[model samples]
Target: MTRPRYGDLYFGLSDSRNEANQDRDSFLQTYVDLNGSTKRVVRGDKFLVLGPKGTGKSALAWYLQFAEPEGAHLALVRDASSLPLAEVPRLQTGQEPGPERTVVAWKFILLCNYLELLMRDQGCSINRNPEVVRVARLLRDFGFMGDASGRALLKFSTTTVTIPVPKLGTIYKRESSSALNIFNLIPYLEMWVAEAESAVRHILLIDGLDSIFLNDAKYDESLSSLVQAAYTLNQKLMENRATGSVVLLLRNDIFSRIALSLPDSQKMRDDLALELDWRVLSGKAGVGAPLMRLVNTKAGRALGVDNFEVLKYFPDSIEVGSRELGVRKIPTFQYLLNMTRHTPRDMLRLFEEIRRVEASGIFEESGDRLRQEVIHEGVLQYSTKYFVGAISNEFAGYAGGPERAAAALTALKAINKQSFDGDEFRESLASVASGIEVDHRDLLRLLFYAGAIGNSIGGYREKSYMQFYHRRDESEIYLQGNFMLHNALIHAWGLRRTLGNEPESQTGAIPLIDRGAARPRRRRRKWEERKK
Candidate 1:
């Protein structure tokens, strides 16, 4: 009898953003409703969606953007980091200071932008609405849509403008109108909106915020302004019970850094924040149900099978027992999760690699289960290789650029030691080949956040779990003197895994590490430098 062959299993497995842009039908099929997030957002109950990188925040945003409900209109703000905050007139009363003014400015900006988008879509005119006409005229004059004057407007400490509306008998005192405060005209705008079609709900989606404020003060301030804008807009809607919502999709890292400084940040978190955490509360668990549900959703839809039975398509296990060359017995899904950073992207990434290896014919096909070599070497190397490359690219915009982070990852890979003591780890990093002087502590913190290394604190079991960071007040690394490379990456990094605290002698082949020095810088250069 002929041996049964493994069929192609990988079907459009990837991060949701890619799926959202490339494959709409498959993206929708694989999308799972995470705890009624779609419902809450559509109902206009929540406006702030927060999560760490790769926690499906963008996916949710894109889902809502395409899945507009019956009575709601969605307007997507593709890039919030580049929002024209300077174009909005700030409130300058003694009680409302700079920050308060900024909040009001953001509210004004959202309202006008939404109105403009709505009008453009419906092919209607704001000519009948005096307040909108005034706001639109000012926004256009200031170059709200990429005007040089817009940059000038951002630098203005105060603005003064005079508007004459004979129909409404509204005239600003020339002396008192030194600043164009939009809040002063709010009553008129509200009146206009209340009288207009009140049934059609308007939803604004603000996305593409990741990697925006890495280490730049200008970008940071811009993000803060966007957050403020969302908050102010929400408050305005709630006050009038308006049929509009402004949703801000942000990374947890970015939000955490800015939330403490903003006055109403707590109110937003308590009332409107939706954290897209995929990990379970228990530390020992390999994977959470939410992450698995996402995987199953995609796999089932792709393979034309039931989502609950996704495990049937995968190998039963990667290893059977503690013995060397253990027969493949551990389920492949759990094994993959154990090596992951507990993210859907990582999970899908590993599966994509598996499919690639299977297609490459690197190892002989043996039924449907992956061979030990294929599972350990091919899949692990692929995942870790891409993950390390991504980190290098992520840190490429900072002071030292990609080399700063790549040097750390390379040092770890070259050391080729799976688990090490605090002193040993510190010594290894210090003795790395690269001459660049990354702070030893900063190197560890970087690795911890990147999910390259995990800590051991007596009871916790995940080799890559960095509980120390979570426990710290500032999310800094608190090394417990012992750490282990993630089991999945250990093989790719040419490091040995341990059995009962003893190093296994049969470590897989080591792969070459990219030192990151020769890589070209891709971040935007300064103006003078760009001129050259």
Candidate 2:
């Protein structure tokens, strides 16, 4: 929030112009349609944004509204139930306050957008349609003629038209007094269409609604909203292919629950539902294209000596072979510190506190990169809480916990020893390392993915490994990947070799963690008691 130095790094404050640009990008050019490699992506009726919190589902929706990719500006509903079935507006409900209101709000968007556009330049002007005139006559016969006089089907002034209504089909209205009032949805939409020939497409995006507060009965309100909206859009819009879209963005956890609750979740699959798999961005494995875009955007302003010589997001790598392997593709300003994050959100959260601390005047001068205490803190924060998320939740059936996790990291380097072949070291680790047991698999895989360890003649070498960023002046240690990759597991490995030889030496082989400025061995009893 510290203004990001007012350079290219800034995503820009939300204003009218910025909002317009963002909407354009979201609808027309932001995401690449990757179906051409062989076949096309199957377009579906809905788009479910399934990802963890902070993975940017809501941000994407905001971007969609800003882009207005389809032309008409977006409208959001705050709540579905609150929608009176007559009023219409695009819905964009957020998590705070009331999320359910979002669906209810958007249920009325189509009518609102159409009516708004009609009254834009003139008081009221519209194309003539026989169907609309017929429905208008029917409504007039029933004394339902809204506060307007149109020669059958005439241009209604925007100011004169007191409300937003879509020029769709004949509107069927049922007041709360009727038992079938809920079923009046079809008639209400049709009646509006009867007033005009212009087809106003409304893209309703519903967000919020998670299990954080709702009771079990209402926990998957987002899902229920999605189902209902999908049905409504298809039925009212005649399953039209060119217009109307409803995007429901929710967490993968909620979707999973709904899937189990439903008789068949697969039956509802659609193109609009999206999943944000942040794990894929780890290193260069995922987000390769988007990463390039981010880097280009950053490198432009960061290295501002010559703005005209604008370089590609990546430097012309005619020098460093593409397969040489590196992480310049990461976008976070603190990316150099994370050394392990895989998603856009991970990098952001990993350095949020550090960014706050730095901007607070703790670090203002430049050229302190090597000795910056923030680097040390960033390393600790990235690996400690996020990297683990509790070893059990992270590793599932594999061996977890910091200690065993460290050992598994070491084993991965052993498995990929370049002195031999990758296959040889992997087989060796698979056969001998007990810490490489089941649950530990993903941890090791992740380390390899992060490029923390490399197979080489001298075992595994940790090139960028930092030994507490607080000691920036010290030369970094580079050695066998297993020993250098995960310190605790390396110590465990060393102790394993000495176990049959000398008991005292084995005790010395185990490394100690630095509690503060001092490194001390962990007491097994103390740790176990803490766990209990």
Candidate 3:
């Protein structure tokens, strides 16, 4: 068996939807089912998938919508970014802008989508049912043949319609003077759904909510309402014995804000949410880990090999050293994984950089595997570009957010240390604090939430640990504890070791001490004590 050239290898697109769109076959084939997420979605056990950006939330959604073995399921993806969400709250029946009215609006839109699906899939059968036919005609008259805009759907809501109930021999009419609206159509839509005989289960996937995120009350209310509407609509489907469900893909931070405004947030999280956290365990960062397995699967498919070992295409170990622990060799996979925030997109970006480096031929390679220098260069490039860009994009929705984030990063870089106590961090940002709208503490929290920095919990004696916001969405950032910049951003920011003053190398190559070797050294006993 011959090995494939590095130039010929494919690491998949960083965007999940792009990969699905451009390479449908490969995308479906290489999708890693971490924690049986696809299965859970198929079973309607989970409807909400929450995670920080690049944690594969969208990947899981696209997989559910397009992966083969559809067996008894018809999945459709509706990207929320394409929908006019801002116009949704305006369509509220009441004068106030709140989630209640928006929830009703979302229900109407979702119901229209379901009706369109039924018309497309179970058209002949649904036409036989008077209620389903009436509902379909109502939606069709409003220009909802699928892919209708929010404004279009709003038109459907406000338009008065009279439907003749053939079975009851009476006309169900809405007076031109009355306030009858979309909410009134909900019961009829639910009736149609309950009565229609569709053999396959309908799964509606709502993704790309992050694309249209804005830091405002209305945006928050609209998003929160969408979640509530999905939950309520799904419950109605289940209660009415309709084999259908609605799944929402949301970023953890956005979901956190929505959760705060929601009264039953905990209950919804417990019953409806499936967090796509792929943080690998200390002992399990090897071949079997989800991130590594995903890479292996994609590499295998790209190379036309079955059961490809990731280490086969990369070095076994990389040299790492620190003052706390002498020079030691750590697994290359672990080293690479540490450079990421435990997300598949991070790994994919890293590999994509490696491929680019390989194609450039700037580093000498043995033609069998990626050289340590190549991987280091790839990490540097990925950190400086993709990682930092991702962090900037995370906070871009807020006012002065991008500038403030850049200023905060500059302050961190000026501090020139990997880890710092709260005061040092606060002091470092003081010079740039004037331009930033948020207080120093709020800025710290923003950095924490973006996965740029994390609290350093525990002490050396207890095996010091780092807790990132992405890993613990429910946990708060306590400024009382020490904080460490994420490894992925260390190179980009040119941070130094916590104990030393030396700046990080230009390639961002800091010798990280192996976690196992970072234990507190035991002091040698005195001679007298030994004699005793």
Instruction: Provide the overall lDDT of each model, using Cα atoms, as 2-decimal numbers.
Output: 0.57, 0.35, 0.69
Q: Each prediction's TM-score against the native?
A: 0.75, 0.42, 0.82
lDDT score at residue 420, model 3, on the 0-100 scale: 85
Candidate 1 lDDT at 228 equals 80
* Whole-structure CA lDDT of model 3: 0.69
Q: Which lDDT tens digits does candidate 1 get at residues 1-532?
A: 2322333554454556677678776777667767888778767788988876666777877776666543355545555545443343343322355566665555555665566544543433344556466655665565443224335346443654323343332334322443334556545554444334443566677776665435565455556777887776677666777656788888777777777667888888899888776654312332335666676676666555663444444556666335674543544555566556666676677766766676678788645456666666556665567665655555644667666676677667766777666666567776774487766676676666556665543221332222323111134344655666765566566565553432211111110010010111222124326657
Q: What's the C-alpha lDDT at position 502 in model 3? A: 22
lDDT at 212, model 3: 55
Whole-structure CA lDDT of model 1: 0.57
Model 3: per-residue Cα lDDT over 1-532, one tens digit each? 7766775678889898889999888888777777888888877888888876788888887887776354667778887877766667766443345667778778877877877766666532665766466656756666554676554746634444333343321124533333334656567676776566766776778887866545687688888888888888888777776767788888877777778877777888898888886654423445567777778778887766778876677777876556676666666766776677667888788888878887887877546877777877778899998988887776665667668777787777777778887788777787756555557787788777777887755534354445566534455677898877878777777665674432221112322222211221221124324656
Report model 1's TM-score to 2 decimal places: 0.75
The model with the greater TM-score, 1 or 3, is 3
Model 3 residue 185 CA deviation (Å) reads 1.3
Candidate 2, residues 75-192, lDDT tens digits: the string is: 3422232222212211222222243443443343333333333333222223254434443354344222332212211222111222222244333232433122112343454344
Root-mean-square deviation (CA) per prediction: 10.7, 17.6, 6.7
User: Ten residues in a row with the worst lDDT in model 3?
Assistant: 515-524
